[model samples]
Target: MSVVPAEVLPGGARAVTGTVRATVTAELGPRARLWPSLVAVYRAQLSRARVARIPLLFVATFQSVGILIMMRGVVDGGSEAESVVAGSAVLVVAFVALNLLAQYFGQLRASGGLDHYATLPVPPAAVVLGAAGAYASFTVPGTLVTAVFGCVLFGLPLTHLWVLAAVIPLAGAALSGLGAAFGLLAPRPELATVLGQLGMSAALLLGVLPPDRMPEAVRFARDLLPSTYGVEAFARTFGADPDWALVLGDLAVCAGVGVVSLAVATWAYRRAAVR
Candidate 1:
């Protein structure tokens, strides 16, 4: 058999080479489906966060519980008590989903961790959603404890407490997206932490404090806050006859803001990844 010259390959050999090149290109191309990558990222994020975040979750729950205890001394009942309880419950979500997530992403960015993710075939949305989902997941136990504890402390009926099931996720998504955006957009990790802290403080004050107590200016600012909708949604449930329509509207607003914020975070992730 005669060996073929390198530059004068037969048609069959050329076709085979072309087929192999196409196969390699297809194998090396970007991922098409996002769900599998999203799930993998979510699981990885959840596992990494579980151990490191437990203590912070404890602190978040404790802080909200402590707030309820303090409010117990001042407000015995009425709308003020309801506001305090609802605000405190949502605060747990803000602490972890917002504050801690910002810090995590900020530090991750600052430490060049994005390089690792950037090299992967995963979609940018998956990283943002996975991290946000994982952080938001941590808020559940804390939020539930805070809500139940606040309800018992204030003598509120548990009948409407079920509203928290909707409140936590809607509120967590908004807050988590905001946190991720802050972390990804900030110039430094320290700034991200500061932004997170300030955001949480705003949620605590504007959300927990009765709207009646806030000045017109402060109340206007509160109205602009995404968590305000969540607070209103949760607080309205405490009443004997809640306007379910209004409660759902508030939740819808929260859901909308959550979508917008997550979109922004995804953009921020892409921007940061390219940097």
Candidate 2:
């Protein structure tokens, strides 16, 4: 018996009878079937992530409350508009960054989850998508909570609201990609946590604090953070103003990080131990 690869097309037709065609047709099956399968994989992966990250979620919730308390004091004396804008913008970035750190560590555990994917026939992109999806579920919702609290506490407007919603998920994707990339540089899980802390501290010193207040060198260093633009996006949303240039720039940075980090992650993952 001869084994030949055949790609079946719609209507009992064959799209490719040759060596497995490189082209994957998304339209081959009924449209409804593809998404649920992909989403199921994503959900399964996310469940593992969620299970491992209960402590992280608890900590983030506590941190969010603490920051809200701090911002309440700090936002005093500012105009209502300015207070909400400033508070929400800063907190949103912090929230997203923390979420990224949590998700990165979840993935970093070397817990054989990464290995399981290595054996699957599923595409690598699917793996990345699933992992990112799982993390996004955690991070994106927190931003909403942060935003609403900012609004109620500081009178931040939800005008141009869709932009606010968009920023969270966009930041989520970018941060998850960055997390995968950072995971490559960190060889150990503990090291990853330390590095994430140091990185966020740096981001906070630069983005949360005004640059004018920082020494030149410290301010200069803040330019390296991926969360800066996301913070700006949050601020812009509060103002109901769209900075198209900033949006494009953020999108480009996200694309660059996702592509480069995925490459590095894939290589590093190949070397990752799987039991």
Candidate 3:
């Protein structure tokens, strides 16, 4: 039988609610309700997962902070540490890129969890939505940790605190989408790593290192990377102190790419799984 739209049963559970109730409810309860119960069940599941993963999350955060601190030391040295600054630039590009790939692919393979989602009554779209929310949630704590480390080590200022309000999330989401795109296409870990390196190279070529310094021929090739928007947003925010539109436009473009890529990936996964 074809998969049916899922509905919530009593006690906050979801079941495939179709005409063929016998087969569907034989495994999942029949007489399922709708949204509220489904949401409740999802929330309970998420709570349990967050609780289980809290310690691991903390350790990762601590490690990331240490990495940022070391990078920051090189960052604030100004021109005296030009090489360090370049390294920091490369590191940020790498950091942003890795955050996306690590979470997207690592969790799936490490936990061997894709099949779990395949077995659920929930729509495939739901997985992507949940993944997107979780990815967005990551941006919050990650940004906070990076910020604290930046201030403590490199002495990054909050002179224009509003700049951060607009900058960090957009950059994170842009990078996150690129990471997710890689996972959708990557068949093996080595291939994923290669893609990740390609992402870094593209970022450095177009964004982090500034295309302006490169010849027209060079920038032409790197223009393929979606990261230029993020870099431009940050650069304008700090260097030119231009209008808010600069960052907003950049963020919009980044978000547009992310949304489109996510949609395509989800569609591809669903068709492949159903086959």
Top TM-score hit: 1
- Please report the TM-score between candidate 1 and the true structure: 0.89
Against the true structure, candidate 3 has what lDDT? 0.51
Q: 1-275, model 1: which lDDT tens digit per residue?
A: 67966667655454455445544334567673578888888899899878787888889999999999988998989999999999999999999989999999999999999999999888899999989988888889999999989889998988988888899889999999999999999999999999999999999999988889778999999998899999999999999999999999999999999999999999999999996
- What's the true lDDT of residue 129 in model 3? 43
Please report, in order, the local distance difference test score of every candidate based on alpha carbons. 0.92, 0.56, 0.51
Tens digits of per-residue lDDT, candidate 2, 1-275, equal 44544543354465667887698667543323435555876887678656776676556555655666675765562343343343344444444344354346445544546665666555555555566657656665555666666566766666654665666655556666556545544666666666556655655455555444568777567566666666665555555556777766765665565556555554555555343
Using Cα atoms with residue i matched to residue i, what is each candidate's TM-score against the true structure?
0.89, 0.69, 0.60
Global Cα RMSD, each model: 7.4, 11.6, 11.2
* Candidate 1 whole-model C-alpha lDDT, 0 to 1: 0.92
Give the range where candidate 2 is weakest over 10 consecutive residues by summed lDDT. Answer: 77-86
**Clashing residue pairs, backbone N/CA/C < 3 A, model 1:** none
Q: How many residue pairs in model 3 have overlapping backbones?
A: 1
- Highest-scoring model, lDDT: 1
